[model samples]
Target: MSEHPIELSTRMIDTGVVDTPSNRVTEELSELADGVAIVESFSHVVAVRTDDGLVAFDSSGSGSGAQVVEALRRWDDDPVHSIVYTHGHLDHVGGSAAFAADAEDRGRPRPRVVGHERILDRFERYELTSGYNRMINMRQFGGAARSARRLDERPFLPDATLRPDVTYEDHRTETIGGVEIEMHHCEGETDDHTWSYLPGFDMISAGDQFIWNFPNCGNPQKVQRYPVEWAESLRAMAAKGAELFVPAHGLPIAGRDRIRTCLETVATTLEDLVADVIEAMNAGAVLDEILHTVTVPDEALDLPYLQPLYDEPEFVVRNIWRLYGGWYDGNPARLKPAPDATVGAEVVDLAGGIDRVIERARATSTAGDHRLACHLIEFAVAADPSSPAVHEARRAIYAARRGGETSLMAKGIFKSAEADSTTVIDGEAPPLRMIRDLGD
Candidate 1:
């Protein structure tokens, strides 16, 4: 029996400035074991304890982490000895310092951080897209996407990296604090998600692999993930005879049969989506065409656990394309794209006058159609960026659609665009265009 008990915390909050409704939505669903208490750090700190020691997880450190430690204090004063990170996402890995600090004060063994080997790479990718990420985060919080100011540095780095700390080429087993645990490496959600099983408790802690919402197979802003691999992982977990399932986000699921059904349903949905996407690609369809073509069956969509609260099927299709096709979408016009202004100006001339486009934009915005309105306004803005009418129209259209958005990822981008259009109206310089200029 292992001496150190791994931890899980239920406490989490939006550490960033603009908190989305989804943040709260996700929080209300987090759960831990019965005898083993759950703690809330910021809004998402999660931890668990056993006979040996404590094991905690999540990244809402500082305020969030402090809250988690306080919650644990409500139960036992035992020091935490093990920390398991589900993946490298900021909210999951950011709160380590506070927990480690408290454990230090108690003279408990310093918590050993564990995570997938790819966490380091995840951090590097975040740094590379810092400007874009910062903007998205601001939008996610309902703040301005870009600041004329500078970076805030909230997206932190992980310490005590795990080279599969316990190491699993595919699946591996370990016993922490006398709690029999199983860890499986999955390529879903994030590239190296760890789905853990505690046999003694008949509980399964599926990191992001099995969230209550529809699988986040199609995150709009992040890199590619393997849908096939994700499906396989879900099926593998469903086969486990766990009576209790604690998802990283959302409610706890009980009963072996129900859990198996939920797991199987998500797995099948992803598999179908991937198969359909690949079939479309094989038919030589472009990315946009493929995205518009693939659809999730209403049966799967109807599942309460399969809500599209985070990501949609279209985004997953695009991610799959990236996995197979790299950056270029095989369109020769985009092989070496011209500047937006250059293309927009030519397109505007072809469509007649810029005023004609703005008139169409006004019409679309008036009809309560932001998607078309934004498309028209983007051309006008890119070409005749100084037009106040165009700016106001863009801002208004985005605002109308913003509240209707469901996922934080989607709301963030749309809100940011709205803010940028307003900034242009207020005589503030917009963000550097190079941020979204793919080749740039």
Candidate 2:
């Protein structure tokens, strides 16, 4: 048995994060709506009553905004005075149009929309990377990528831009209807994240910075993230001494000590992880070599709050490398490389035909050597996508790989292989696993 108990647990589990699947709206919404009324499209919504009207934050990405609006209707018809966005992620701002439309109908003041100045730039970049974004969304949502719809328009745009409206360079204190909101800007999971502190009520909304899982500073398909800066931000928030810390993605945390310890541990782990990677790089270790060598401290990884469910420390190391150093990993072969298929075909030919590669892949896969099996099968498939043996080998490798995975990135890669394979993996399995026993 592993020494660490938290390795088998997650922030959602340790903190007792529960979103009971109910036809009923969230109790937070149910209670808050009793007077000023606010609905959240998805399960994650925060509503606070101010002197002027109600201010609601974030409509969930899954089109649950209508449910939130309806829940608010049950409470009161008082217009939504404001809607503040923590960041520009699709999940955070995808359902704004519905609430905006509702607020328009009552001759009630249109909710003044607010977000960081960089959000507009964030949206435009999404427009540029629409195709890539579509592919990633398909993987995240477990569906075929949205090919027919315009990715740019598919994500709803915010109104009355906060591009500069009520913008703060570092921090700002704003009171809406007598409710004091302390705004602090920090770059973490996203470049444009803003955390709101309701000092009067002793509540804070942490946006993506303190997402229940590991800090996702190293997403495989997204822009560069600042892991070191992210750690600093987490420390800053922890120092605020908030009584209630409500995160954008998971359950709300009550009590100062719990919130502070959780956030500080995340910060310390990341800053140390970055230092580890930097030390390895300074010693002239290459990227792949460093990935195999560097590791976050065991104590940090064992923390319930820092599970690598979505992203891993190695990914963060890679991001840091990209930020400070160029893409060159000091490898001459990759400096001016041939296309992937060309290289794969050469590898397959050297292995004495595709059949030999397939056979070897099957043996490796059966032996639970998925990393090796994946490389062999991927080369075989890439060299000849139409070959039945290649397809079979790829499917077998993918299925074997899925069984040993923990992080979301690994699962997504295996799932993509399954999707492209001629034969699917036999049965669906959960991604949750014990992390400590599987060690460096």
Candidate 3:
């Protein structure tokens, strides 16, 4: 098992040292300035001490919340005056209940919860699609069916989520404990993302906008992200010229020039991608053609921070097409196409038989054409799902695909597919696995 909560084969992006410790297990609490400190949890929680009380940005994820609160208490026992959420992502706001509970125990009044008004809508959506979210998350994280089933038994949105008591439209400035925080709302990873700036400290708390890795504007399973506006928001942050930059997911960065370069490079990457896709659209190019043609420059990709470790640029191009072009993929036949199973059956018939199709899939996989291999295997399974030979081959092919994938999202989904094939071969109830001793 990896030491980091989020594991990646790639090396950590090379951002200048801002004093983040190597030991993430201990939750290093680094004091950036006189009254400011950051608790480096899965997602960081920033605490700013003011004359009146403590003002915190993000509570961290569910169980991590209590740990963050304890870390903050160790630094200073000031009552939390307010909690500002950067967005509605569970990791950012799940810990709100812990902060509230700590305040109550200390005999202090409830801290004001502030966020973009759309956060309420996000929570409501989660409630409505709890089952669907669980299934996708299982695929997203490559967890077993038992894990997803456990999640289904509970509420998707935690009861501990402290909804925003105060909401804003575009921007708002609040004075908490004599410290002023300027919150600016913009469309990015989520519609409700807010980037806060503290004039007194010359610091900017960029929610998910400036995470150390590549910008997550192209999550495959998530709702629509704003690439065009995401670029605009980054440009706006670069213009702030803040000395200290605090991101929700990564270590804090100090120095104006380093911060500006990081922000501008990310902005330019998004802007160029958007422009290239838009140009292809104007030429009446189809979705597949656009995806193949539009590309991020090598200079941008070479930037350690802009690496495609989480969400790649290809997914972002598809998102732009979805935003502007709607669901039609410029292919009339697909507008109201037959079900995939029906199409697969027909393809199998034309390809001769299930055995032939499986053979072709293995050859395609060996030849480094995993995408074509997947299509062939899908047809084989759909046409003859009862065939033990086909299922075994399907499992092997999917495992190979998973091994070759770079993005966690792709790997997780491929792993899920491999697991599904294993279930069929083992003759277990769909999604159920037989347990074995560890040493076995």
Candidate 4:
């Protein structure tokens, strides 16, 4: 057998350097154990053979659904009898239509789609906010992630979304084709998340819980995430004594010990953040004070799986505050804040003129003060949006900020800003208005 993902992760831990993200979605299928195979895609599709037919966990996304089915056919021709969703995320459930089509073509009935009861509510919410979700996807993903087919774009949660046919509240166990599947409801990335385990196979199909990056509990563009409950779920999975751990997005790990260690490490890091943030919150600390003071230990972050590739810990701090503290942000003036443009104009006026603000912005940027440079550039732009010189400086400053970020979330937003300034300069568009930028 090829080197298991666990072996690679183990070596990475030993070297103290993460070579790549654990959430790569290359479309390929590999079996780490007998009768079980994992298809790596935008989200992984884990196929388990059973006497009744094939039981697949997560069918991949709409873009890779056919590829997932093709890979499974090359390995095992069993008709998919049941497809389990790890959550309501499009990447996790988008491929169910493809699976259903495959079954129909083979003279078999459609596979039963299964997930947590809250998934139904999630689908309803997506339908209600499809327009906003579509816009968010375009900004956040740059390319059309909301569209299933790259060229033929669809709505964010298109009418074609395959809603779950079976739903559970907390925990459920059932025998399918003589093999038992245990599904536990847990909230982490989504309120409707579910992690499944196969007792006989000694494997856990952990949805997005243990993705190789820091738990994406703080995605700025996304809704509220549960860091407190996220840590608890990881601990529960670790106690299962599973020999194989398959995640929906990243590399699947092998060996009971390796699985436990990786899960425990991820759990502890999150638990630590929650504890530190809550303690600060309890002391009546303002969000700004807690944000600047609280930090994840360098050692914990240096671990292979704990790398901040997708979402960093700083955003997580903000999310924790949002969950318990409400949106006031502790700034008295911001509570009933003036327009962003109005505030920027005031800052520029304080600096004497738009020209002075632009000069300082460029100088501060060159002096390795990119953060302050950005604020100054925004002030200059607000004061004189038609200035080509200021726009060029804004583009360069945001590009520099993008270069210094580690997480994809930060990089994308900064890149979006850089691109926006470029558009204003190149197209001679009207003064750039700051919209929520998404990444390419």
lDDT of 2 at 389: 63
Better model by TM-score, 2 or 3? 3
- What lDDT does the true structure give each of the candidates? 0.67, 0.68, 0.80, 0.82
Off by over 4 Å in 4: 1-6, 14-17, 143-153, 428-440
| lDDT by residue for model 4 (1-440), tens | 44455566667765776666555566767876899998878788999999999999988888889999999999999889899999998887888888888888999999988899998988888878777676555555652222221234456775565788899999999999999999999999989999998998999999899887888999888899999899999999999989888888777877788888888989989988989999998999999999899999998888777888879999999999999888888899989977766777788888898878888988888888888899889877766665678888888887787788888888877776666566667754532254321111
Instruction: List, residue by residue over 132-163, the lDDT tens digit for candidate 2.
Output: 67777666445231222223454333442233
Clashes of 2: 5
Q: What is the lDDT of residue 149 in candidate 4?
A: 19
Overall local distance difference test of candidate 4: 0.82
Q: Write the per-residue lDDT of candidate 3 for residues 206-310, one digit (tens) a residue.
A: 989977666788787899999889989989998999988888876566778777878888998898889889999999899989988888877676565666666
State which candidate has the highest lDDT.
4
- C-alpha RMSD for every candidate: 6.4, 8.0, 5.7, 3.7
User: Higher TM-score: candidate 3 or 4?
Assistant: 4
User: Which has the higher lDDT value, candidate number 2 or candidate number 4?
Assistant: 4
Pairwise lDDT winner, candidates 1 and 3: 3
Task: Give all TM-scores, in the order shown.
Answer: 0.85, 0.83, 0.90, 0.92
Model 1 agreement with the true structure over 364-403: per-residue lDDT tens digits: 8778787778788788777766566777877877777777
Best by TM-score: 4
Question: Against the hidden true structure, what lDDT does model 1 obtain?
Answer: 0.67
